[model samples]
Target: MTRRTRRTRPSPTALPGRTVPVAGSIAAQSPHHCRTSPFSSRLSYDSESMRCRKGRTPRTLILPLAPTGPMIRRMPPLLTIHFLPTTVESARLAGTVAVMIDVLRASTTVTHALAAGCDSIRPCRDVVEARQLAARPPACPDNLGPLLAGERGGTRIDGFDLGNSPSHFTTTAVGGRTIIFTTTNGTSALEHCRPADMVLVAAFCNIRAVADTLVQRNQPVHLVCAGTDGEITAEDCLCAGAIGLELQDHGGFDTHSHDATRIAISRYQQLAHDSDQLLAELRDSHGGRNLQKLGFDDDIAFACRHDTIDLVPAFDTHSSTIRTLS
Candidate 1:
């Protein structure tokens, strides 16, 4: 005689159990199948379990509503982008990823210094602290003597080794050097974000590369504009928008941009057809106008070029210096 095994079927009203029929098979036997199962109670699916009512897929019922009437997309929890006219407004960057940009010179110079093989760029808000750091000896084996570098009013600080110009960061001067750098606005912006999770210095010269690094790190990023004397500067806003566009391209996290940010992005897109025109816009920018008056017009021109370098400098708080992120 041959023996046979009989499968058991759970009652329709029974709670989920070991002997429960396969989801589809049980559903096929019930007239109220659409109203049955765990999903019926909550109207949603369990993400972890990967199980849902027989005919429902998680996304089918949870589709997002179409945005209407000047809607701004909601940002995710991890990433946020802020737009401010000055570093003073960036005081809230303490626990976030603060990215400081002074596209006309300071940030570009710092990037150039690191690219030229400087061990580190020590950004100081106080000129006095900058002088003190420059007076101190290097703390590492590869250390070169501290090279004092900074500027006040677009001119080299009296008695300093170098000024805050990208042109001054040539290999002959910055190679194997430890630069104690200070600036009227850029360094102050960096200092404001000193307590951040990570502080980065950016400019048009290294915007794309910096954006790539930020995407890899997947941390919350705040772009701080070192505007001219606490006022809004169009150049910095444009640079911020460039970085914001790249962040959107990377596609992992959401972006929260202010009115300034939206305006910058609009301006950038408008000028995309003619870069020279965009560069010309900088000549009239608040910061650019001040630099020109102070005889640093060349610096503004140099900073407008996009993707001039692949270096991304990150502030190492422990050493109080900006170093190339590996």
Candidate 2:
């Protein structure tokens, strides 16, 4: 394959000692202390003087003089991870693509619901809110009546049509129905992320799809973990780290990436090499332990599997619905 070359003019105020394309070869020019003849790529410079590296005639090459003013730098795009919803400031989410993870159940369930042909999902903050939303008339003429789905204390709430299990969202049950969902952490995290430019729901099952979507969008990202009962959960962080690792193959992490992201990345690396270990870690995590006590081992296994689902669902704050991204 032939590489295409593009020409760009060197800025006078470029960073000190940074490499730039000059003539036909690469040149390392300092904007402040050193100067070089533009025509010769063989010239070298030190703090004291400029000299030719080889025996060649010294020639004058006119280049723009470096500027001696204050330099304004642009902020690099960031892939930040918040261990809990409370850790993120709403203002920072204004222009970022937010990824909300509740890997043990909520996110995984939502992804399955959409894939199973649910019309849409409206996330409610509480059981009462979910019931109220379900009782309300459909906003659109063609929209189906909403079904109530949620969990409290890791068990299905009384009088609800379904629970927060990925298996509960099968095509035979959730198909052709809208779900008014409420959960302890996931739904509330979605509400907290309403200010973001875009909100995406992610779990281990659809991690690759979420990472691919993030790479295509190429925007600043905030990975918000819906921690278990106001405490950080290892499962959510692991999912975020898995997505972040995939993103590394695309743009990679920058200086602006958060410390929490680093922690999550490190946690993920521990089990990244073994699928069995990854499953064990999830089963031992805080959220995982709670589900285990409730005998939801199947749900935990479903959520721990990576790249099982290919669809990436995004939350629309205006419509109050979660739907597959176009």
**Would you list the C-alpha lDDT of every candidate in the order shown?**
0.66, 0.72
List the candidates' TM-scores in order.
Answer: 0.72, 0.75
List runs of model 2 lying over 4 Å from the truth: 1-76, 139-144, 252-256
* lDDT of candidate 1 over 81-156, digit per residue (tens): 4444342355566667788888777888998777666777878887788888767766744555788898888789
Badly placed stretches (over 4 Å) of model 1 are 1-91, 140-144, 256-258
lDDT of 2 by residue, 1-326 (tens): 12112111112222111211222111112222112222123223322211112222322223334477665443435889999999988777999899999987999899878766677888988887777777784663346567889999988899998898886676668777788888889999998899999999998767767876786676789999999999999999988888877665444335235788878877776676655667788889999999999998777766765544457789999888998786
Q: What value does the lDDT take at residue 174 in candidate 2?
A: 76
- Quick one: best lDDT, which candidate? 2
Candidate 1 matches the true fold with a TM-score of: 0.72
Top-TM-score candidate index = 2
Global CA lDDT computed for model 1? 0.66
